[model samples]
Structure formats: structure tokens, C-alpha cells
Target: MAASVEHDSLESMEAPQTAVEVEETKTFKDLGVTDVLCEACDQLGWTKPTKIQIEAIPLALQGRDIIGLAETGSGKTGAFALPILNALLETPQRLFALVLTPTRELAFQISEQFEALGSSIGVQCAVIVGGIDSMSQSLALAKKPHIVIATPGRLIDHLENTKGFNLRALKYLVMDEADRILNMDFETEVDKILKVIPRDRKTFLFSATMTKKVQKLQRAALKNPVKCAVSSKYQTVEKLQQYYLFIPSKFKDTYLVYILNELAGNSFMIFCSTCNNTQRTALLLRNLGFTAIPLHGQMSQSKRLGSLNKFKAKARSILLATDVASRGLDIPHVDVVVNFDIPTHSKDYIHRVGRTARAGRSGKAITFVTQYDVELFQRIEHLIGKKLPVFPTQDDEVMMLTERVTEAQRFARMELREHGEKKKRSREDVGDNDDTEGAIGVRNKVAGGKMKKRKGR
Candidate 1:
């Protein structure tokens, strides 16, 4: 009955306690973090605890199971990482903790944070996710790292097939983005994992929202969990300046170019709805000398990492991506986010815009709402509880770019078709060029060199 009541209240979207109540004067030491870990936090430049960290860490240190409700980029990683590290320090063990995330990229990112925070103590972590050879991952698991971070699907593959490996003594279990994990249809895998791991272990479930699925998972996974919700409602950050541009669907590329030109020197992350559009738009932007790149599920794992590294390193100014990049992976220098294609799910808008305006930094999000997307746009507005103003763009300025954009579009489509045909012609071409990297490589050989010289134009 208590579980049912808790579900009802969370379903109603009431935050148990607002994060604003957390005292700003509180530091990592105040949250009961160990001295070494506290110093590690300082070295990483995290001088103070974020609200989620402040609320969740103390209870976690007291050995309470936690259901942390916070928005994306709210330092959810630290809230759980500190306590897990604290426990690890007290009781040293191999295969100490397991972190499950929705995407492979997020798995690597969490591993980085755990290593950074636990570095002084020489903590070892292995990232187990798909798109990499299982043999390598098997060897990684064989070493029995202190922590193993993985996505649900690949982790299951290892559990069933890998020899001489098991989490029989696992101490901590963390589902970083619980809502997205379930949403990706990993319910069965999660259930299997839950059955294998010891229930006596500490568990932390963190998510951006409390949906019915998450409520069910919470009942199944957590035991008398303390709910620490930082943001009670669905909303964007205060520092984000959000606007919308209503234009014909055909003219999206033109307007995108105009905005990129207008906001020159600013880093941009443009979200597309499909993998094809993401690749095509990236090619178009690259052709126009915008230093564009693409990150999506179709690319090989290595290429995906390369694209992300280039974007993060500022080697590339524009990253065209599918919804896969929208959730938990943080690239801190983004100045603008363009929803080149509006998201079908209204809730995704929050996560997409969240790519920017992170860590107290100001940023901009401009969504392109075509006539077909009006209903979806309205739903997003209604969800966020505010109507977005139209972004200022001169029609003539946008129209002037149509000729060049059209040529780029034609070249992009041709490149995609030619690449697809090349893949069919040779079986050896299967692995590397199977996604965006090969297409980009082909562009370099075919026309990117010529386009590179015209970048400043």
C-alpha cells in the first residue's frame, strides 16, 4: 500500500523536497565524502556540491537506497559516485559496483567520472558496452575492475556467454538514467540482472522523470528507497534562452545555415530526428565549410568516439546528431543547440535543450517548427508551461542561401547514394564506412578539399 501511494504521488509530479533548500555553503566534505575523494573532487574543479549531490549523498553515506529525481546534467553522477566510492574505501572488493546506462556513450562517460573521483585511491573501472569486441570486454571483466559500467544489452550478452565471470559479490548497483533504460525496452534484461545480483546490495536509481515504468521498476529494484528530487516539475534551465523558428520543412537547411552564419564562432549541436537526416545534414554543413560532424547509432563505436572527441576538443564547430546524443553524455562547451527537426516526444525537448545551459553556463536553444510539427511543438510548449517566442531571421537572408544549400544538398544525397553503392560492391567495405565516418572520408576525397578552401566564405 505504501508503494502504491508513493507511486501515485510521484505520478502526480510532486517533488518531495526542492533542491533550492540545499545550503549553497555545503561542500563535498559536508556531504560526508572521504578526504581522498573530497580532494579528488577539488582536483576535478568541483569545489562545491550541486543540489542533487547535497540531497542524495548524505543519505547514501548512511547506507540508504536512493531514488534520485533530477534533470539531465544536474551532477547525478556525483550524487551516487561519492557514496559508492566511500563504501568501496571501507570494504575493498573486486567487482565492487555495476552501473547500467541507456547508451554506450554514457557508459564510457560514467566510467570516466568514477575513475576521476576515485583516481587518488587507484580505482580501476571497465566500460562494458556494445559496438566493441566482446573478447576485449571479456578480458576487461576478467581483470575484475573495481567498477563495471555498461548498457543493459551488452551486459546481458556478457553475463550469458562470458566464462569465469559473475557479479556474485557486487556491492553497489546504479541505474544512471533509469527512465531511459526502461524506455529503451531493457525491462526484461534489467529483470534478469536484478535476479542475478544480490538484493542486499545498495542500489541507486536516478532519472529525469518519474513515469509509470520507473515507478514499477522502483518497486521491483529499490527497497524502502529515499526519494531525493531536485526539480519537481518538467522545465528547462533558467539560463537557457529558447526560441522557435516556424518555416517550411524544405527550407530547414537554409535557415540552419543562416543561423550558423549569424552565430559564427559559437559551438552548435543540431538535433535531427533520423540517422539519415543527421548524416545528410552533417555532410551539407561540411560542404558549406561549417566544420560539421555527425554522431549517431549507425556509426561504428570508434568513429562515434572520434566524432565526440573532435567536437569536445573544438576541432569541429557543429555536431549533427540523433536523439542518442541528447540524454546523459555531457560536452561542456556547447553554445547553441538547434532542433533541426522537432522531436516527436515532447519530453525529449527538455533533454535536447539540456545539452547546453549546463553547469551554470548560459546557452541558446532554437527549435525549427515546420507546419507538420505544430502539434508536437504545441505539446512541447504545454509541457514546459510556456510559449516560445519566434526567433528573428530575415526571410531574404535565408532565401539568399538557398542556391548554395541546394547544391550542398544535392552533393550530400549523391555522396550517400554512392557510398551505399560502394558498400554493396565490396564485402571488405562493411566495417569502417558502414556509417558517417566513411561518408565523411569520401567527401574529403571527392569534394571536401575544394569545400575546405571555401570555408571562410
Candidate 2:
């Protein structure tokens, strides 16, 4: 009964009748954003503001604390960034704003967007996250970049340890993906951060959903924030074609290979349930001569960024990842999202499929459901409020590749075992403390070449 009541309350929050309606075609200049930032927006190809931006920007410029509830792929970044940049232009202060994200990849992605939008104005943003070196990050913080983007735990470490580094005068605080942050159980760190930052600052909390924890944090962090909600209900866009395939558990790899062959010219972001599975799938796909890369929690930060940059640059066509990539890392050219393993939680299904069909581009999401996954699959359908159509498959052709897939799977398993052993040996050789929480190795640098002179801007 309590769950049902909570569900109803969620429904009400999602489809609120009293929410402010924003004009879809509103421009940034009309939203009271300065002409210089408007030029930055134009350079980034944002001719008009998104719905969330339209609603939040004007109020944000008016100095209102904001709680923006919008779905994945919505322009939540811009809704917070433009206003922050606009404010930075006025004040021109270092360590002006702090943007907190859930994951390292999301932190990097947000930093990229902030840099791209603030480039013309010479905005420097530092990213602080785990699996990266503290010394380098300390150097970055020493420089006192105008903006600091960080994950909670790592940021807390710095706050406590890094000398002469504090956000005492921070003008703005943004909790991007606030729901995920709480879900990851970073409440203690967030509480610590809240205690340290000045109380006279503007706070913007943006989340895909309004949960009890987010509400609690909002009350604690914000002072009468304006609610900007673009999507009150959980639903995929019309352009996303979602489908499911019921197959035997053992033949999952074969089906994936068959699908990749069938959908040849398109890039794919395949979701797996475990880090081992992600690595195995990438190895399997690569063994078959496909340019597949893996990203998961266990990987070092540099490799993770390398994989993401490779995918973003189209150097790799297929990316196999765990839920780390699901929430906020936006890759523009993902043509298909293959759920190689159906998510256990129904809500995760929404985020996994959200990778594609973003920013008005049509895309496909296919989920593999085994006999044991019927109940879970049913739960996802119930959550989405619709029955998914069956994705067409050639079973005979899929069976034809089973032998090759089995051999590849064996190779993948062996590789995983060897990799695990190597990790175990390394841990034994160099005590665990050597890999400090946020310690990062040298990044793989891009090759430098002579610059071709360009015409004046």
C-alpha cells in the first residue's frame, strides 16, 4: 500500500498540471543571457534553448535557486552552465562555481561542455574524480580555475587534504544528477561539502527524478528554488524504437554477433550487467575483427577516458560498458543500444536505452531476455507502461555462428582469468596503498602535429 501511494505521488510529480510551460523556440538572448555568452551558444550550435533551458535560464539569471527535473538527453547542462557563465563574466572570479556529477566520465563530459561553451571567454575548468592522480589535480586546483567539476568522494578527499584549497567564496553550487549521487550513498560527503561551502551562494540541483533524498537535499541546500520540470513522467522519446528478444542464455553472444552483422554500418553501445561481462564481450567482438572497446568501474581513469574519446572520435564503432555509461555521458552518434543483458532494475532500462535516440535523432534499443528473465522483463514493461515488440532475428543464421562464438567465448574467459591473475599479482607486488583513491597514471597523449594557420575569427 505504501509503495502504491509512492507510485501515485511520483505520477503526480511527473505530470503536474500547475508546472510552468516553456516556449520551445525561446532564444538565449531573449532569456536575458548576455550577448557574449550568446555567441558561445551560437558557436556550439545551440540556436535556440531547450525546454529546460528556457524555463530555468531566465529564473537562474534572476538569482533564484533552481530545482530542474528533466529526463536524460535533455539540455540540463546548458540550463545550469549558461547562467553560471553569465555570472562569471560579470564577476570574473576564480573558483566561482562547483559542478558535482555522479561519475568520472560524466564529470569529464560536463567539463568538456563547460569548456566548449566558455572557450571564447577563456574559461578554465578542472575535473576532480577518483582513479586520477591527486598531485595533478592539486596543481589544477592551485591554479584556481573558474570552475571545478568533481565527484563527491574525491572532492571530499581534496577538501580535507589539499592545502589552501577551499570553496569558501564559491558563488554557485550545482548538483548535476543529484538523484544518482544520493543513490550511490554519497550523502555523508555531500553533507560535508554543504557544511563547508558558503551559505550565501546560489544552488542548482538538477535531476532526472525527484526522489525523497533529492527533496531532502533540496530543502537543505536550496532556499525556495523555482521548480523547472520538462518531463514529469518516465517515458522514452517517440524517435526511440525499443525492442526485445527472447533467447537462450548460452546463445546470447551468438545473437549479439548476428545483430552486429545485420546492423553493420551503425555504431553500437552495448550494455552488460558486470565488468567482467563488458570486458569479455569487448574481447569477443574484437577477436572477430570488430573495433570494440570496454568501459567499466574497474578500469583506470586514463583508459576509461581513452575509450570514451576513441568512441567519440569514431575510432571505435562499438562500446561495451556497464551502467557507468548509462546516466549522463552523451555520445552523439550512437545508432543502436544493445542490452546484451537485461537490467535487473526496471528504472535502469530507461537510462540504458536513453543512450541512443538523443537530441532528436532516431535510434534503436534491443534487449536480450532469457527464459530466466521473464519476470524482470515484465517489470520493465510495466514500468515503461507499454509492451515491447519482438525484434526480428534469423535464428538459423544465429545458430550458424554458434561454433565460432563458443570458441571466442572460451578465449574471452581465458583472457579474463589471466587479467584477474595479473591484477592479483600487481596488488601483491605493490601494496594497495600505492594506488591511492584518486591516483592516476600518465594519460595516453594524442600525437601533436604542425598547426595549419586559419583565417581570423
Q: Encode model 2's per-residue lDDT on 372-402: one tens digit a residue.
A: 9999999999988999999998788889998
What TM-score quantifies how close candidate 2 is to the native fold? Answer: 0.89
lDDT of 1 by residue, 1-457 (tens): 8666765564355343433336444688877898999999999999888888887898899887899998878899999999999999999999999999998889889999999999889999999887778899999999999999988888888899999889989989999889999888889999999999998899999999999999999999998888888875898899999999999999989999999999999999999998788888888887787788988877767778888999999998899898888889888889999999999999999999999988789999999999899999999999999989999988997899999999999988987776566645544554433221123322222223334455646
Runs of candidate 2 with Cα error greater than 4 angstroms are: 1-25, 431-457
State, as a TM-score between 0 and 1, how close model 1 is to the true structure: 0.91
Winning candidate number (TM-score): 1
Candidate RMSDs in Å, in order, are: 4.1, 7.2
Candidate 1, superposed: residue stretches over 4 Å from native: 1-21, 426-457
The clash numbers for all candidates, in the given order, read: 0, 3
Model 1 Cα shift for residue 188 (angstroms): 1.1
> Would you give me the overall lDDT of model 2?
0.85
